[model samples]
Target: MAAAWHRLWPVLALGTALLLAGCDEIGLKSSLSPQPRPASLRVVPPTPVAPSAQSLDLARYYHKVQNDLLTRGLLRTDGGGPDTPYSADDLARNFEKIVFYNEYSSGDGLSPAQRLQSGQLSRWSGPVRIGTEFGASVPPDQRSRDQAQIDHYAGRLARITGHAIAPVRNGANFHVLVVGEDDRDFLRRRLQQVIPGIGPAELDLFSNLPRSYYCLVIAVSGAHNPNDYTRAVALIRTEHPDLVRLSCVHEELAQGLGLSNDSPYARPSIFNDDDEFALLTSHDELLLKMLYDPRLKQGMTADQARPLTTAIARELMGQQPQDPI
Candidate 1:
């Protein structure tokens, strides 16, 4: 197990795939908007070091946050039973909302989700090679456990979407970083080395990340073809509790692939901001299947995908493809 330990420096936020929270939604690449300047990455080999006091405090705070959320009956992990049922129409509508909507308006930093409905279908046109990186502060055992979770989840996503998704150690197009607060300075430098053109304002997004926000993702696509994603990254805080950390994994990694927005009406779904479901629900799996269905191609508008998704949703639920809602 390899890790990069930080020197207890400050932080930075790079731009790419959209995030689940405000930070991600602001400038994450999507078919809905003009692509950001094309950027590439250079791997920063892992280094071992100790964590700072603030990182430890952040860990304790997140544990408390997780416990409080559980106490309030949030962050469910049951995959949603009958009480949270959705309809064929619901499924199709939710799929459109999740795929074709934008969270914040035009911006450079984190902001409240504006629900700007302007996104288009965008997914990796090629294989998705997922690579996991950890901060030095993370214990070796925890790193192993986290890597296991990502590996299994990648397999689940592959099975559902029938896409080439797997954990890799080289030539990865999607990078998932599990870092703590104290490692911010190192991260800033690392990303600066990886994405040399990353702006100061963008870096401040990480340097001054709000405590309310936990994790985010960034993606890159060709300027001419917004639908085709090439490179991406997901930032998952190591401080969160087990389930919450897993929740970040499920949501952000999926978001990095394509599903870029959230909808209030999406029941039993991780795509919803309500936090009712901690993990990807059965409903989410069906959505993934529908997303990769050959009928609905990338760069498709919601209007372009509506009829096709409805029909696909029917087939997924064992109903006749042409059945009326």
Candidate 2:
């Protein structure tokens, strides 16, 4: 019995050692091995993804609210223009782009979107008068050419908005100042003339403007109950290429008339920073028409105008005889 016990103890000890070795090989190899350390201390951020469906729904809801505030005029929707009409979707999308971007109320330090939703977008209750101010550096021939371009665009604007757009020598509400790229002094002087008493801080703001800023429009409205535009100014950089100059002219001039925001989503329209189109497309024409329509009045909040805007958009779409503009 003693001999058998000793023999069994050795066999049991051997089996126990074998089991322990198998467990170590199966589970402890990864723990014993050294892991590859990260190469550098830099940590990259994750890329932005598209807006989720819920996020898009929220955006659409906000857009609908803003559009409701845009509807206030009495003009009939069937009054079609020579240019083809756009779809309701296009009209609403462009309307959102126009109203939510491009602000001329920087003097008051209000965002374009804030001013728009609050019914602060400057409106021309009176005649829409335009004028051109040429810098001393501009040659006579070049001045003439610029004036011709301005006149042609002003006419197009008048035709599209069905408003009285006339070039005024004096008391012009909208002044287009054409300046050379290096004409910083001229730009400052004209800007001062338009917005007098702007402090050094404001001047500094303009002086340190981004290099990409080639042109801008500034429109002011009085403290009247309806918020009618008192004056407006457009600054164009003539040193840019002709196409760029033309594009600036188109965008700045149109933006001065209340659609003061640039939209990333706005395609086939000059009212975008993308430089997709050099001239205003048929889509932009429809927007201008909607803006000047008698139904939309100044001082209307987005909440107040969106319903009417929707109806007007629908009517305009219903009246379309050709393809989308």
Candidate 3:
């Protein structure tokens, strides 16, 4: 029995050594043993920046101006005033004429001479005129305000287009007064009235105004009738196709008169496509805002600024076709 035990002892010792080695490979001892902990990681959150007062003021100013301009006419409480309500038909007709020019010039980018006849050219270069017949009840203040807005937009237009736009005095130019429900309808009627003499050819409403000024009458009152506003813009484009490239009125005014449209802070590009709205990258918005700032207006021409503007515009637009007008 002692001889058998001695032989088995060697086997038992070897087996115990093998089990210990396997435990080391499998980390069983480490699993069972107490261990020291690693140091804690420190993480800090980013700080936020507040917007400046100047930025807030400019935003507020823009909002107030737009609201004032939009609500000018409708806010009047006096019952019997100049009614400028226009029918959809009037708008459609004016739209049709304006759209004709939009299509004509944009078709293959025709020259003004090729696109417009002598008659069309005559009307465009002649005067900035408005024809309106008010009901005896319309207030004088309302009339003045309506005219003022036109003159304001016209002056802005002139500054942008390098043309001198002045408002002709009452009864000095062709004033066609159509008795209508409101200014919108009156404008439509006036436009229709003018189309026969001016011919059906499209005029660049923006470009063709007399270097001086002209007025059109609206019997309906509200902020410049958007229908009239749009039609007038279309008419301006019809008469002067060159203005189409100068789309944004704010940018156009700033750039045309040698003002800076760029800013230091990040902002969305004015030339951005409607489709790209919220998808703009921060870098791209920063680039656009810089270009649109008024302070940067110095020593820049439209030609020089166009490439940078276009690049940022395209980036904002993403992988899409260029915007149509």
Best by lDDT: 1
Residues forming the 10-long window of minimal summed lDDT in candidate 1: 1-10
Error of 3 at 311 (Å): 12
How far off is model 3, as Cα RMSD? 37.0
TM-score of 2: 0.64
lDDT (Cα, tens digit) per residue for candidate 1, span 61-123: 778877777888988999999899888889998888777766554542444445464666878
Residue-level error in angstroms, candidate 3, position 321:
22
After superposition, candidate 3 runs with Cα above 4 Å error:
1-138, 170-193, 197-325
List model 3 lDDT by residue over 264-311, tens digit each.
Answer: 122222212111111222333233243333332322333443444444
Rank all candidate structures by their lDDT, best first, as comma-separated numbers.
Answer: 1, 2, 3
Off by over 4 Å in 2: 1-86, 100-121, 319-325
Give the root-mean-square deviation of each candidate in angstroms: 6.4, 29.3, 37.0
lDDT of 2 at 66: 28
**TM-score, predicted candidate 1 vs. hidden true structure:** 0.85
Residue 212 in candidate 2, Cα distance off native in Å: 1.0
